[model samples]
Target: MIKVETGLADFDIGSETQDVARHGGGAIASFVGLVRDDGNLQSLELEHYPAMTQKALYGIAEIAKADWALHAVTIIHRVGKLAVGENIVLVVTGSDHRKAAIEACSFIMDRLKTVAPFWKKEVRLDGTDQWVEERQSDIDASKQWDE
Candidate 1:
C-alpha cells in the first residue's frame, strides 16, 4: 500500500502491521515521522508534485522489495499544514525475518529523505516561516545505498 495526500494520516499502526503480517511475513518493522515541537516550532507545511511524489515513493518501495524478501510494504506521507505531534510519514515493511524487515524499512526512509519530491516549510511559534533545508547527514545516509 502507498498513499500520498494532503489530509490527516489517521492510520492504525497495529492493524496495518497485521495486514502485512498475514502475507507470510514473520517480522514487521515500521517507522512513523511526526512534527516535532522544537521549542520555536509551531507547525509544518508540506508540498509535493502530485504525480511525481507518488512515483518516487513507489520507486523506493520497489527497490526495497527487490533488495529484501519483503511480503508487503506500506508508505503513507502527509501533506498540507500539520500541527506539532501530527503524523508526517509512515513506513512499514514486512518480511520473513527481522533483519530484512528492519533493513528495508531503514533503506526506504533513508532514500526518501534524499530522493522524495517533497518540500517542507517550518512555521515558527514567533510567526516566522522558512523552508526546511536538506541536511548533509541525510545526503550521506542515502549515499551508503548506492550501487
Candidate 2:
C-alpha cells in the first residue's frame, strides 16, 4: 500500500513499517528529513500542488514496488509554515531483505528530490525568502537509477 499526505502535523512511518514487516517481511528501512536551523534561517515554508503531488508520489512508490519485493511503503510530506526544527518528510520501505529495503528507501528519496513537485522557501537571517532550486546534481542522481 502507498499513502501520501500534506498537513501541519508531524509524520511517523517507522512504526507503520515495523508493523507491516512483523509478519510480512524482514527489514523496515526508514528516513526522516527535518528542517535545519543552520543559524541563518528563521522560518521555512513548503508548497506543493494538491493532486499533482500525490500522484507523483504514488508513481514513485509504484516504481519501488516494481524494482523490489516491497511489502509496504509509506511517504508523508508536510507543508505550510514550519520552524527550523520541524519535520519535512518521512519515507519507509519494507522488504524481505535489508539490502532491498535500504536500496529502495534511497531510491525513493532520490527520486522525490528530483521529480517531486514540492517547493521550498527558506527565510534567511535578514528576513529574505528564497525559493530553493532543483540542482543539477539532483537531476544527475535520478538518472543514475535509469542506467
**Which candidate's TM-score is highest?**
1
**lDDT per residue (tens digit) for residues 48-111 in model 1:** 8787888889999998988897888988888889999988888889898999999999999999
Residue pairs that clash (backbone atoms under 3 angstroms), model 1: none
User: Clashes in candidate 2: how many?
Assistant: 0
Each prediction's TM-score against the native? 0.93, 0.92
lDDT of 2 by residue, 1-147 (tens): 666666778866556666657647888898889999888998888898887998999999999977988888888889898888888998888888999989999999999998888999998879899998889998998889999
Q: Candidate 1 at residue 113, lDDT?
A: 95
Q: Model 2: runs farther than 4 Å from truth?
A: none
Task: Point out where model 1 deviates above 4 Å.
Answer: 1-7
Q: What lDDT does candidate 1 reach at residue 62?
A: 90
- For each candidate in the order shown, give its overall lDDT on alpha carbons: 0.86, 0.85
